[model samples]
Target: MKSCYLTRPGLLCALGADTDTVAEALFAGQQQGLVLEQGWLAHDHNAAVRVGRVAATLPILPPAWQARASRNNRLLLAAVQQIMQEVERCKQRYPAHRIGVVLGTSTSGVDHAEWALEAHAAQGQLPEGFQFEQIDLGDPARFLADWLELTGPAYCISTACTSGSKALVSARNLVQSGMCDAVITGGVDTLCRLTLNGFTALESTTSELTNPLSLNRAGINIGEGAAVFILSAEPGAVQLLGAGESSDAYHISAPEPEGLGASAAMQAALRDAGLDETSIGYLNLHATATIKNDAMESKAVDRVFPHGVPVSGTKGMTGHALGAAGALEAAFCYLSLTDTQGRLPPHCWDGVADPALPALPLVQVGQQWRPGPRYAMSNSFAFGGNNLSLILGGGA
Candidate 1:
């Protein structure tokens, strides 16, 4: 497959409002971004959990997209705003029908609906200006397509945690197959009571700061954010070299215990990039901090990179962004390539290794980054055994 360039990228999360700020905090291992507060979800009126909430004020939606207004849309709009100029240039470079938008999301305005239902429960009527379609998963894509006046293929992907990464794969397919000339591809997800409470019900919500690969690891902290990347055939500083996908369907919530599916995805990614695992300088793990996930992922990492590569799970820095996680981490890798100081994102944990899990090298703060155009990979494993791995060859 021909290399697809990831040109301009925008990001917003608990770490920072934009890519540069987030990258600085991420590689420096700063904890100033991940803050905790009470009442994370509507269902949890009592139990307070730590969450990665965006602290910056959001922009008002355009009157044209007011009908689809929601926090999710706001986050996506924020990401796009950072690169709007480049986006407009691309629109002019290609016909409207030749440009595409493909995004991944988990909670699509579900929070707004939650508020509407509350209003109805008390007032016996829906909110005055409430629109029920805000909960639609495709709303983000539709709004972006409509706003851009793009006539090419536009759609949303909601494949659990792998949604964002798979969207990248889909975008590459569109460009490679001559279906489109340029693509605005990435993902957005907003925090909501449904996701928070749902994970809590499954005993996956941890009360303490998430401890990825720690012996005392509890679970994950739910979060929300957006990451947008302009992908095209034009050469750029970073390239989306390969993506590997697998659906092992081992369990609904739990991954395959033996790490067969997870390892396969990593191996496939390396294969797609035509590189050996040893060539990878840094690895962004899909370590959710859950007992099962860390254990399964550790085994997979051990199998693939036996020589030991610097690895880190960014959930401790930004929390788990769920559907937006894959692309968000990829943006981190993109920054890794652009950073001239050569600093790798450090592993933020308690330094207590899980005795039962396979031991792998974890990147520490102040560690020297890989020199030159290095290779990196980000893992995103979702429910129903949906696992996706993306490989980038640039700065690591």
Candidate 2:
């Protein structure tokens, strides 16, 4: 398989609007990015739950693309703006048809639909600006293709939380199949009334900052953001070495109790990367902080890296961005792999650790890994047992 090089990544989440800002804040232990607020859902005005909402103003869309306007797309636009210069260079470097686009998203314009319904209920008519296609799972991809004016393959993945990570796999396939020379891939998700209320109904919404692998852990603090990457055949500081995907179909919302599915994904990733467990320099865990998820993931991590390796869950700093999480965490891995500072992102949680879970080597603040060709692994597991793991680094 061809090594997929992540030439550049653009990410915006609760932590900050760019990679450098987010990295500084993450290692600096600045947890003010996530805030507790109310009125996220229309009916639940008083629910002041902790959430990681991006505090940046998104770029406005052209009037021609107004119909496709939505917060999800806006967030994507913000991320794209960061890499526009590099992307334009790619446009000049590759064939127009050889550049593709693939994005992952769970909520796309549902927020607009929710408001349109409210306007309809109050005024008894659909709003003039609301377009049905804006709610499409693929609109983000379409918008990007048009914005970039490229004719390459474009699509979106919506496999719940695993959607983002799987997008990297899909983009890699496109390039490996000789369909494209380069692909812009990543994920974006916006907070909407539907998702907020649905999670609340499922009792997965947390009221405080989540404590992953902690006894007092409640549930996840839902967040919103976008992450975009310019992937190409040309090598860079960080390369996408391997990606493993599996669907265990364990449950609708709950992961398999024993973490067989999660373990399979991790093991597959290590095998795909042509590396053993000890080769990975750092691990970006998909620690959602939910009791069952933390427990299951712990077992899976313990099974895969028995000898131990540095691990950390960045969700505490950015909250859980859900569909965009995989890409966001992948960015964290990409940063660590290429970072000259050799700083590993610390586990951003309370010091209290849960004794029931396996004792993994979680990184502490200001910790640095050994020097070498850095390899970092990131994991993303979602509903319906959709699991994905990507290994990023210079190959051994």
Candidate 3:
């Protein structure tokens, strides 16, 4: 079997536009979220919840390109462009046809759809302003391919929150299957009235920043961001290691009580990695801070990693990027392994622990691990029991 490795990864989140800003924020333990003050929604008008919104406005593209893309696709474009900036360096080594693209997104172009509807209602015609090209799930991938001028395989995975992780898995499969030699895999999502009001209708939006594993933790706060990674078949590459996906069919919006599907996904990822539970040094948990979701995740983590491994959730800092959450969190895990010399980022806002939850050792402060190669895992569980886990290890 061929092993896929990450060559260069780019990130743009609320922490900042690049990896340096994100690293600085993580190391300094500074929180970047703020309450949404003004937006196009009723619930978001005076929403009290703090969101980790990107501080910089998205860069404007060519007018032609801008007219045919949605806000979320714009974010994805930014992240992909950052990665392409490094492609010239790799071009000397890999063939262009060997490269592929696999992206993860849930509500792709829903924002555009909403705008189209409003424009049609107001003007009594399909809005002359709205672009029809951007209202598709595959638009982001297609735009990225055109931007990079690559003619390889292109795909979009939309497994809700697990979409990003699944995209990574797809990239690995493409390389291993000899379908492509290199790939770009990641995720992007942007805040919109549709998602905000939808989650609000579900009563899943909280009035404050979430507290994962906290006794008083409330619901989740919706956030937006994008992350991309370059994967290649080169030796000494940061290997994908392993990945697993499972579905519980337990409920539409809630995980099963015992975390059956979550556990299966983690176990399968470890098995695919040819590793044991004890070998995982750190865990990037999918702690959205919601009651049922957090509780279910806690149970799953306790079942797999009970040896007091350092565990934290970046959602507290990044908010839940929904469709992009898996990719963003996986990028954090990959960065945590490569940048910090094996140290894991701490859980930034853990004020009180939940007594009813499992008693696993949660690393509340940033701590460094032994300097060397080590293994870490990232978990992403979405609505409808869609679960995905990725195992990443340091490059040789």
Ten-residue region with minimum lDDT total, candidate 3: 32-41
Model 1 agreement with the true structure over 27-87: per-residue lDDT tens digits: 8887666667777666657667788888878889767667788999889999999999889
Candidate 1 regions off by >4 Å?
Answer: 41-44
Clashes of each: 1, 0, 0
Provide the global lDDT of candidate 2 against the true structure.
Answer: 0.87
TM-score of each: 0.97, 0.97, 0.94
Task: Give every collision pair in model 2.
Answer: none
Candidate models: Cα lDDT each: 0.88, 0.87, 0.79
Candidate 1: deviation at residue 188, Å?
Answer: 0.5
Question: What lDDT does candidate 2 reach at residue 1?
Answer: 70
RMSD in order of candidates: 1.3, 1.4, 2.0
Candidate that scores best on lDDT: 1
Q: Determine the backbone clash count of candidate 3.
A: 0
